[model samples]
Structure formats: structure tokens, C-alpha cells
Target: MMSPIASLTLSISDNATPYYLQLREQILAAIREKRVSPEDKLPSSRSLANMLGVSRSVVTQTYDQLVAEGVLVSKPKRGIFIANTSLITMPLESLPEAKSAEPEKTVGYFDSSADHSVFPHKAWAASMRRAWLNPDPKILMGNYRLGFPQLKEQLAKFLYSLRGLECGAEQIIITAGNRDALQLLQHMLKKHVNQWYTENPTYPPINASLTGQLEHLDVQLGGALPPENTSPWAAVITPCRQYPLGISYSSQCREKWLQTLSEKQGFVIEDDYDNEFIFHGRPVTTLFQAAKHRVSAEERVFYVGSFSKTLFRGLRLSYVVVPKAFVKPVLESQKQLGQSASLPMQPALSDFMASGAFYRHLNKMRRHYRMKRDYLESLLNAHLSQWFEWEKPTAGMHILLRLKTPYADDPEISGFLKSYAMTQGLQLSLLEDHYVDPMLATKGIVLGFSNTSENDMECWVNVISQCLGCYFDG
Candidate 1:
């Protein structure tokens, strides 16, 4: 009998995606096409790795994942075989359209604000090595759920001095990142708080965090709160520079929220996401301060920040500053959930921060990011002025451009442009993505400059300008 299935070859690409993922997809495609039948034995891992001219480890990992996923099975001595297809068959019509087997090569979009060009990898690694070499034995143990004490103390000093926060080491809880921080908040506070307010176009993860635990309410942030509704149990807000829009809350709006939270016995979670990179003289004083000073303020304000955006995304080090009253309960919640960060890394981060290396890194990044932001600003002014209007952001990595031409906000136009830009190797995102209700979103563009290196500006600007012009004509 013919055995094309056994002889099937794997194809790979040199795109942004990893080689292992490419291999996985190709094999799955062969299976889906029925070129490899149920119970059909493919080449052994070693054979396939040689045939494909790839690492045996990559092939092994892919096969293992498929085995665990039940797409393939292994016999004691026999080679790996495809699982019975009928048992887990997907209808041909049900399969979504496949992406290009080989994606085009170009600088793909980046969501991070970190400048890869100037990442302080050497400095950070040295710090980690030093701390890892001689960490306090207690830190290596998993007793503490809140952050390490030394790190928390360093964070307390850094936050209080820099971000206008007033949390003691006892009240600080280190988390994996913003998402983990919110998840911990949900599990900890769900018993007492069931109603949460978030910005209309809030970070998508916030919604996911609050789901099933709290009623997520929308707040139209640039102005005042939605008129005279019952106060929520708490409000999760990004105060320093709101996401997508890149606008700071006006003074009046900040005061209004403070007063509202005070009167209604509600809490405010101030997510100071982009505080350190402000192009302006200083960041806005946090609303947490007002909540701290006033009656019962401690319970009413939560300050959340992370080093991921500032230092590097892999750090996964974030923190929340709570009132003294909350320290025990939050820690108890952490204890029960067994959620904590890397054992050895926390001390390294503490050393980095305490040694002033972290702050110094931020200072350098601020200047670098500022330059990139300026480059973007000039490009937008020169090319996109007719079609968009924007407030140059004083902080944050992205700027939201309000669209001038019609039809762009229409689902078709936005969707088409995204596909078109991708085909042409331009990385861009739709402003509509941030809105809770995509239909209600305005026509805008969110351009991230932090990762847009100097060399990238010319090409990116030309691509965007040409795309916008074509969009206008058609």
C-alpha cells in the first residue's frame, strides 16, 4: 500500500514565529488534510528531525505536546502514531482559513514600550548573578506570599518618593505583573466587593480579571463619572497616562473621583503604568495620596505598578500598595492561593532597585523613549496631519490619532487596512481594539513609538502615509 503519510515531510520558515511552532502547525495541517490517516505511523522523531534538517529537540517537544493533546499516541516500542481521527475530527468547513505557510519578513508590530536597543541586559544580569550567588536562605524558601521584604522596602521608598504613593513595606504585595496583581485582588476582595468600575476602553485584562467575581462597570474617564449612579465597590483606573488615548486625567476629574470614592465608601485602584517615562516635568500626583490622607482613605485606594514596561517584559515583577488594614488579608489570600514570583529573582530586583541601577536605567530610557516619541511626532505632523489629530503624549509609549477621513472606523475599512498593512510588513493596531464596545469606538490610531527604533521611522512613516492615502481614495 502507498505510504505518503509515512513519507510526509515537514516544512519550516524563518519568520518571527519560532521553528517549533512552525513545525507543529505543518504537521497538524498534514493531519487535517488527511494525508496522514488515523493510526498512521509517521517517521520517528530522530528520522523526522534529520529529514527536516531541524533539531531533534524541536521535533521531540512538538510530538510530546501533540501526544499530551491526544492528537497523537505512542506505543511502548512502536513509533508515534496519529490518534483515531474520527474520535476528534473537525469538520472541514469548521476549520478556519489557514494563515500563510510562510509569513513575510519585516519588523512586526511590538506592543511593548521597552527599547530593545538600549536594554540594560548586562547590568541586570550582573545584578541577578550577584543576588543569586548569595541569597538569604529564607528568600529561597516559599514562606512569603507578599513580595520579599527587602524588595518591598525598596519599592516603598521608590514609590513614595517618586510616584507620590505612601505605602509602608508591610502594605506592599509583589505580583507576577499587572494581571497577576489584579487576579490576586479579585480573589482577595471578591468576598467583600462585587461591583467594579473600569475605564470604557480599559486594558482588556482588567475585564478578564473581574469576570465571574464582580460586576464590571464602565466609566467614561476624560471627564466626570457617569452621572449619579450608585457608587461601585471599587474603581480600577489608569491615572498617570490612560491607555490608547495617552491623556492624563484633568485635575477636576481627579478630585471628583476622590470625593466620589470618599462619600460612597468605595475604593480606587490607581494603575500608574507609565509614570517614570513622562516627557513633562513630573507625573501627576497620584489619587492614592488623597485617599490616604482623608478619612478611611487607606481602605479606599489601591496603587498598582509594574517594572515590566519600564525595565523589560520578562521581569514579570509588579506590585500593589494597599492600606495597612489590607496587609494581613491580602497576605492570607496569597498564602491560600500559593501564588508568588520567582524565588531568587526578587532579591536580585531588590538589589537592582536599592543600588539605584533601576532608577538610573529609567533615566536613560526616558531620554531614549522621548527621542523616539519625538521622531514619531514629527512623522505624524509631516505625513498624517491632514487625516488625524492628536495630543502629543507627555508620557506613555503610544499616541491615539483621531481619524479625519470617514469609513476608516467602519469594521470593513479597519479590518482591510490591518490585513493590507500586515501584507506589506507594517505593524499597526486599531484604536477600536481598546473599546469595550467596538461599535461605539471612535476612529483613531494608536501608534507605539517606544519600540520604533530610529532606523525604523522612515520606512514605517512611508508605509502608514501610503496606506492612509489609499484608504482615503477608496
Candidate 2:
């Protein structure tokens, strides 16, 4: 009267893994774990192959290897059975000790859960193929450490024209990404710079990067920069579109920062991320432009931007525009540190930029995101009106939602929000925890509307409303 127990075999995809090895491992684990007991009837190789979703040859080879190892026995007429070898699990204490005495270290921080499903794969693939077929072997096989010279030159002209800066090709240093540039720059200036300055609710990665050597100056909106006589060594600021808070520094603020840097004989590392994607009217003039017009060349102001946000994450291309004097040392240090970029990537990106395809793509995405941002603003305004408030972001992929009341701490709120959102097939980001200065963490969440579908957005907005209502009603 009982239903027959169905037999199942392991199956795997051709995701850059070997088939025979996979088959061998699966069969071995089954035998060793006593999942297949001695004298247990096994399916024929063909049947097993079909069940496991692999070729018969793979199964046959694995079984042959196991038989040779005496772990599996095959009969003339009957099917294969497990051998009588002992099954044991190894313990850590029984393992061989490491030869070198190395200290164990574990570092932890907020991990951004980037939504990769939204990547433009078709466009990226086309770009990759174009680069692969490029006739220039220098781009394909040359020392691309200093980066593609053409890309740097184009970037120099672009920055000069667009940002109203006096940057030249020699001053532009290509990097893997924003994080790489920041970390490398920090390393480069760690000894020379003794203090750091940023907005209180600044980007966590930059805040975290400045921990050891430099003292952090946390400034709120309309906050004044430290006096130059104070001798604060350097400042890393997001002048255009501040992270999380989404506030842009005013012209007065930019003047104060420049004046402070000039008097202190310090430097400013201006991050222009997401400036091009501004949803509002024309973006305000950047610190780079401000300083370029006001300060001398020896003042040491650096401008950094990343294409990772604009093009796609995998591009891993960002550039830093330094003063001409710092170029030789920066390039020399890059060479000594073996810090180079992907050869084909720079040329491919260069081709995309020169052909105007990059700008076209940017224009398309900007319009798409602007629409999404408007709709998202409408949804939030309509449903969770009483529970939270957020400043309309001028640019960037994320929108910061400031909770009106502390309905729950980060863990509780995040769990409740994530639970409800996941049930409704919606995703929301908890951005408050991105702060390293714990006191500066907002009672808020970050909504990434760029990656979600319009339908998903509507449904998620409703789900968020319901969730917030439930939390409040109780």
C-alpha cells in the first residue's frame, strides 16, 4: 500500500567544472557517508548517467575508478554495491599543522548586497567581443599598468571640457574601481596625511579606510570646515551627491573647503561618483572645477570617478586626475606596487567612448532611472507618508528613507522589512548600518529603484506600506 521510494542522482551544470571529477566525488561521498550501504543495489551506468544528467562515459569512468580503488564492487550479472571499507570523518586536531606560525586575522564590516540580475549582459558581451577582435596587439598584450594612453587622453579632454578643469593625460591614473582608488590613494598618502574630513553620514568604505592614520572630521549640513591654522592634513569628500543623505555641498561650502585646504597646505580628494546620473537640473559645479579656477597647481587636489556605476560593475575601471607634478610619483608607485589595469578593458572602454556608444547608453539609462525615481518618490509619498521622509536624491542608484520614529532598531526593522519584502518578491536595502561612526547611522533604509521592474516597484511599495502599517498598528 506504501508508495515506492523514488531514486535520485546528483546532477550539475557545465559551469566551468569537470564532469568526471564531479561524478567521482558524488559517488565517493555517498559510499563514505553510508548513504549507500554494502550490498545495496545500484542503478546501471546508463540509468545512473541519465538520472545524474551527465554522459554515460563520465559515470563509467567514475565507477571504474571507484572499482579500482576497491570502494565499489561490480558483479558479473548484478549491479554495483558499496565496498566494506571503514567510513570516517577527520577532526581538526588530527590534521597536519601548518608549517609557518602565522597569526589568525578576521576583518568584518557592512557588505553591500549588490543586485547583479540587473546587469546589461548583452551590451557587455558585445563590448567584450569587439575588444577581443581589436587588431591592436599592444592593447591586447602590452603592459597596460599605466592604463591605455588613449583612454587617459580622452578622459583628460573630457574632464577639461566637462568639469572645467585643467587636467591633462599625464595627470590621469586609471584604477580598477572606486574602492581600489581610495584604498591605494590612502596608502600613498597615509604617512604624509595625518587627518581626514568628510560628512558625518559619509560613505562607510571611505570612513572605514580613514580609520588608522587620520582623524575624521564629521560635518553635518551647513557645517564649517576646520580652520587652516589647525593643520588638518587632508579631506576626502563627496561634494556633488553625498551618500545616504544625498545632500550636495553649497558653493559657500566649496569655497570654505578650498580656503581651508589652501591655508592648511593640505589636499582634497573629491569623489564625483554619480554626478552624471543626476535626476534634477544641471549638477552644481564640482569642487574640482571650483578648486581648478581658484587654487594653484601645487595645492594637491585630486578628482576621482568610476565607470563601474555608469557602464556596469564588471568593467572595474575608475580614473584619478592628479596634478602634473604628482603624476610621475604616482605612476612610479603604481609600477613598483604592480598596480595595473586590464589591457583590453581600457581599449574597449576607449572604443565605446570614442564611438559615442557609452554616452548613448548613459543617456538611455539616465532617462530610465529618472522615470523609476519619480515613480518611487510618488509611491513613498503616497503610502508611507507618515512613517518616513526622504530628500529627493539628485543622483545615484539608491534613495535614503529616514524613518519618522525608531519603530525598531536596525536588526529588528531590517528583519521585519526583509521578511515582508521577500514574501512579496520585493527587495529593499537597509542603508543605515553603512555608517562606521555609529551615532551617525540613520533610522532609515536605502531603496535601489534602478534594478527593479515597474511592476515590482508598485508591488513592493504596497508591501512596504502594509509592513509599516503593521508595525505601527501594533
Candidate 3:
């Protein structure tokens, strides 16, 4: 019989992440969240292995690894119990050796994780150094399913100051990144939500994430927001700056979005992907504030913001401000998922934001990205104006050049150009590729201009133009 303490959820993926490591993360998360308390017994390795449908060896290895880390303790002829480590600062170098090999790093052609040239290495490192040296061991590892308290408090302030959104620290739940944020929401709300609505031409992976768990419904975007014939449980949208299209959602559009949520008492997952990148226009009214009169502030919107686009993707730090009602449920789901991001870095980042270093970094990057955006736009307009049509994006790291290709509906040319561009080491996303119905997908390639330096911009664009020239001028 499975013990009452054996309520561990282990979702095994047949990916590079080994099974033992996944088990370790789950147990650690449970401990940190206090879902499993100190002196509480854990299921025997044999029982856990059988429950999880894996080899008993896997569970034993995971338990042993945790024991070595001082996260768990064992008693002879008894069972494993959560360690009473009020604070744990086990040095990585002191841990038992693991069998996994370090993975190699690779850059994508469209990589926009961070501006490699301008990252505040010294500032970030200085903050982290202070956090690491703190005498409190809890800072090293505490179960913050909602996120480090310091980070949440600081982030709540940061969001209000920058985006004009208002919420308290309790409302903010930090996950590894947007992906984890969505997964946690899915885990918590799938029972209540039957369908998750998204924009038609959204990044494909956003829909891909909900596959199997819930149906993803794409509402075609155009001049006006469409009315929902049937109410959805919730909608995930990048309203401020719709992905790839670079168009901002109008007030009328926002009204419709709010209406759908109000009718169903559903929620909106607002992905503020390019929250700070707008080069023109006033900040779009946050979906949260827009819905305040119609519904309570917390019930209407789920504000999803990621440091990936704003700070650095590698940071894997993103925040979601849930409605007050959903806070406890989301945290419970996070505990079950055993999601633990780097604890030391969260507070360090919180300090970075509190000290205003984050804003400083953003100010610097905005100017840098603006200059890059201008250079890329100028190059494309000068050389390839006849072949493409596009608007200057008010904000974002990439611009979608809607191809005015002579062969309108033919995928052959667009497909060939995409394949050929790769040979020249140019990485880009086709706008058409993001659409659910291929016919509705627009023609053009999405260009991410953030990574290329000014000196390299002309060379890379010239090569890309020549690549397009072969197809167009042919």
C-alpha cells in the first residue's frame, strides 16, 4: 500500500534529463514547499519505483543522491525521512559525483536571449556574491513554490513602476520561465478549463505546450476582435505586441478580450513578451487594469512576464501575477511539479532590481536594440523594398517582413528561400509558419536583429539579400 506520504508526482520525459535527476528535483521541491515535512517518512525505494513504473534502482539512486546532499536522512531498518535542515548551504563541489555529462552550448541563428556584448556581468555577479555569502542557509535553498520572497516583493514594485500594473508580493508567482509558468497553470486549471484560446499566428510552441492536456483554440486576428461563440476557460495572448505581426491591440480589442473572460469568469494569460521594447507609442494599458471595472482585478487577468525577453533567456526567470483566488492552487501545483529554479540567483536578481540595476540594464539595451532595429530596417528598405512590405514595429527584438513575393500563395518559393537562408547561416522565422491554417499564414520571414553587431549587420543583411535575390531576381 502506498503511504499517505507517497503522494509524489513524477512525470518522466524520455529526453536528455535522466530519470534519477527528475526524481531528485521532485523530492527536493516537496521538501522545500513543506508539502512533506521534516521527520515525515518517504515511501521505500521499492514502493516508489513500483508506483512510478520505473526500476527500483532508479528510486534508490535518487534517494541516495538526496541523502548525500543532506536533503534527506535514512535510519537503519526503517525508512527515509525529510531532513530537518532549517537552512541548507551544501556546496556543489562537496556533493556525490553524478554520471551525466555536461552538455555543449550552441547558438541559434535567431538567438535573442541577451545582448552578449552588453550583459551586466559585473553588476549581476556582485549581487550574487553578496547573496551567496549571506550567513542564512535558507537563502541557499528554501521552497519558494511562489518564488523567493525578496524577488517577489521587488518584482511587484518593478512591475508597477515600469508597466503600470498593481499587485502585491503574494500575487506574484515565479516559475523557471514562461514555459514552466504555463505548465503550472495547466496543471492547476485543466480540470476547470476545457479550452485555451490563443491568437492565430502565435509562436507555434505556445500551442504545442498545451497539446494532449487541453485543446488549444486559435482565434484568427484581424481588423476587429471576434466574439466568442462558446466560452473558453481562458485565453493566452501577447496583447501589447502580438508576436510576428508587430501590431498593438487596440482598446476596442481589449474590450472584447475582457468580455470573453467576464462571461465565462475565465482568465487571460497576458504574455508581455516585448513589454519594454516599444520604440513608439504609449505603453498599452495592462490587461489587468482594463478589466478592473468589469471584474475584480485578480479575477480577470494573469500577467505573464519573462526575464528571458527582458533580462536574459538563460536566466529562465519569469513571473505570473495570478488572481488572488488562484494563488494557493498554483503554488500547490508548483510544489507537485517540484519546480526549483536557482534559489541564490532569485534574491540576487531581486536585489539587482531593487537597486535599480535592472532598469539601468533595460535603458542601455533599449538604446542598443533601437539602433540595431534602425540599421536592419534601413538595410532592408534600401535593398529589398520591392520584395517585402512591413511597418516599423513600435517595439520588439524582431520585425516581420511580409513578403510581396510575386508568387502569392505558392509555398515552393517561400519554402526554398527558408531552406537556402540556412546555408548562409541566416536564422529566421516565417510568419506563415506560425499560423494554424497554412492559408491564413502570411508570407515573409521574421528577422531577429538584436544579436548582430552594427559592423556585422551590413554583411549579414547583404548575404541575406543575396539569398532572397536568388529567388526573387531569378
Candidate 4:
């Protein structure tokens, strides 16, 4: 789960005069626009105060003003509620139109939808200062064309401890981010490999880059088609957590992957994005675990990971741990393409990991996101149980909801749901939206809870639940 405030939402600029008044105004606007209608008790005073980094009195004063204005009402036992007043009944004429006539910019690339204001700037600033004050500039300046030696070494050790793997510094090839790794990997292997296999309901960017020839698989359901016969030259999979579907590939299924790859001459690209954020029971084993059991004649297994899911997206750092055989070609491709991440920042990243700051920060974020995940999960159980079937992911940032519908085609339903999600500030992918085949497109919407706050979660989920009413009974 992501801190709603950390998603770069609700900016507070220097020109935001009368801070408390600004916060109050924002709240009123949401209420006026029916974004938060009557009976919608805003986040608790303490929570909102913390969210805005203001004194409790400030919130109290604003609440008092709304109460006096008859826009909000407080009950004896039940906390504050939006008053069912004329203001609530009146149409948009009473309220001013949205601030700009210009349509709001779409949240596309570089638009994380993260509440970045919640970032621990003070702490990060301290880390940056510490790095600058240190005597060793080589860590910052020296170019390890083979990628940052220190970061790779630290990551290798960390992976060994965390995921039970044996990796050397030489096996790790650090790059700008996951996209960079994908592009580089494709460039390196495209000639040798023509087809790329992916889960039917996978991430969009992954499908987009593969020239739209994604292999659609129906997750880990007991009775389904095994991908072994596909004979894909290469496959990219999220074994730990399937995006949107929130399904984890079963141990048997993982073994099946290894078995299939052994029989065929292909490799599996294991994308362990958000691998450390597991919530239920012990974290699952990595695809690398299966890799150790069976080494194909072609050495068909490559491991990839990124830091964007755990830390902020701006980090723009990801790495691939390639098999020894592919190392030469991958490095050659990187050199030809100038595909290296921030050379200097690698040491800072290394220092962050070596000093245990990475783990420390991860533990803190895990705790925070766990709370958010749990809260959202509880809300879903309470209100959406009838409409959706979902399994809580053992790890990862988002969840998949299987919606029941009378429609025979899944892609149509997926598109319908996707349109609704986008309207309410949600950027979600439909289960079948990434499929190359229309038969694979009819599924459910993938909800990303990482970037939304607990306060907004309830409101948005309510809207979605209502929209799902048409299909809920089916």
C-alpha cells in the first residue's frame, strides 16, 4: 500500500496562503462537488491533521466553521457527517465550476499518482548530506561501466539472505529502471528470440513493448491450460504476485514452469517487483528457487527486479541478474546503447543498503502499507463481498477483483470497468486489456491500492461497488 499523501497528490505550495483555510477549502470543494457527499465523514481529525502536517486546532477550527455554516453536522455518538442541507441538494450552479476550463492533464508516464508530499524529506536530506560529507568521492564519481560494483555487491548479499540465492557482483547488471531492463533485454535477445510469453492479465507496459504478442494464461487456477506446449522462445512473468489478479502462481505451477522450460529450450524472465511486501503468512519462494532445480541446456532463467515499488519512482533504478552465459551479450548491448543508470547515485544506493537504511526504510514502509492494505481489505470485505471475489496477495502493491457478469465476452466488461476506474482518479488495467487475443480479454479490473489513502479508499471503493451493482447479482 502507498501513502496517499506520498502519491504527489494534494500539493501544498509556497503560494498556498492561509494554510488552514486552504485545507478547509479543499475539503469543502470535494463535498460540494459530491466527491464526498452527505454522510461522508472525512478522515478523522487526527489523521487529517497528520496528513496536512498541521495542528489539531487548525482542523478543529475548520470543522467548526463548516458546522456553523450548516454544511456539516456532528452527532452525539457518531462523529461528524455532511449535513443533508440545501447546499447538498442544490445543483452545480451553487458551486463554482472546477478551477480550470482546461481539461486536467492525464496521469500518464512520469505521473506516479503517488502522494509525494508525504515523503520523509528531512530524513532523505540527511542521507544526501551524509553522502556528500563522506571523504570517498570514488563511490560517487568512479564509473563502473559494468554497472555500480558496490550496489550490485550489496544487493547480491541482500538477495542471498532474503530470497535464498547465490549471486556474485558480476552477475548483476544495474540499469535505469524496469523499462530500461526490458528494452535492453529485448534488444539483446530479439534476434535469437522472436516471441515473448506473458500472463494474459499482466502489466500494460510489458505488453506494449513486446509488439502486442503477449501469451495469455488464466493464472494459477487448478484446471487450466499449461503453457508448456506454447514453446515460447522466452517468457516474462511475475511469479511472486500477478498484477491486478493478485494471484500467486502455485508451487506446483512454479514447478510446471521449470519442467516446461527444461523440456523446451526457453528462458523465463522472473520479475520480482515488490517481492518484499508480502502480507499473508511467509513470503513465497522466488522463481529463482525453481531455477536452481533445473538448468536447461540453454540456461533458461533470468531474474529481474526494480526499486520503484518499494521506494519512490524517481529512484529510477532496476537491475537484472543474468546467467553467466548471457552476461557478455547483455553488457555489449548496454555499452552499445549507453544504457546505464545514474553512475554516481549507485554508491548512495549502496551506502543506503550497506548502512541498513534500505531495509530499515522497507520495514517502516511495510508496516505502513500493511496498515493501509489491511484497512482497505476490511472495507472490501464489509461492502464489496457480494460483488467481488478476491484473494489477498501474499505480496505486492495491488489486488485483482473478479467481477461476476452476464456478458459472455470478458474484454467488453474489462473496458467498461476500466473507463469507470479512470473517471474517479484511478489508473487501473483490465484483466484482458493486455491480451493479444480477444478470448483472453474478458476478466476483471486490477486495482492499485498502493497510491490511494485510507480516507479516499472508502469513497472510491463505494463508487466502484455501486457501479458494479449491475453485475453483482450475477
Ranking by lDDT: 1, 3, 4, 2
Candidate 3 lDDT, 198-298, residue by residue in tens:
77778877887664543445534432253354654667777787886777777677777777667765667888877787677778878886776675534
TM-scores of all predicted structures: 0.76, 0.69, 0.76, 0.69
Q: Over 4 Å off in model 1, which ranges?
A: 1-107, 213-221, 224-232, 405-412
lDDT of 4 by residue, 73-122 (tens): 87776667777777876765674332424556453211223335455666
Model 4 TM-score relative to the real fold: 0.69
RMSD of 1: 10.3
| Candidate 3 residue spans exceeding 4 A from truth | 1-108, 213-232, 296-298, 405-407
lDDT of 1: 0.73
Best-matching candidate per lDDT:
1
Off by over 4 Å in 2: 1-135, 140-142, 209-214, 223-232, 405-428
What's the true lDDT of residue 420 in model 4? 70
**Model 2 TM-score, all chains together:** 0.69
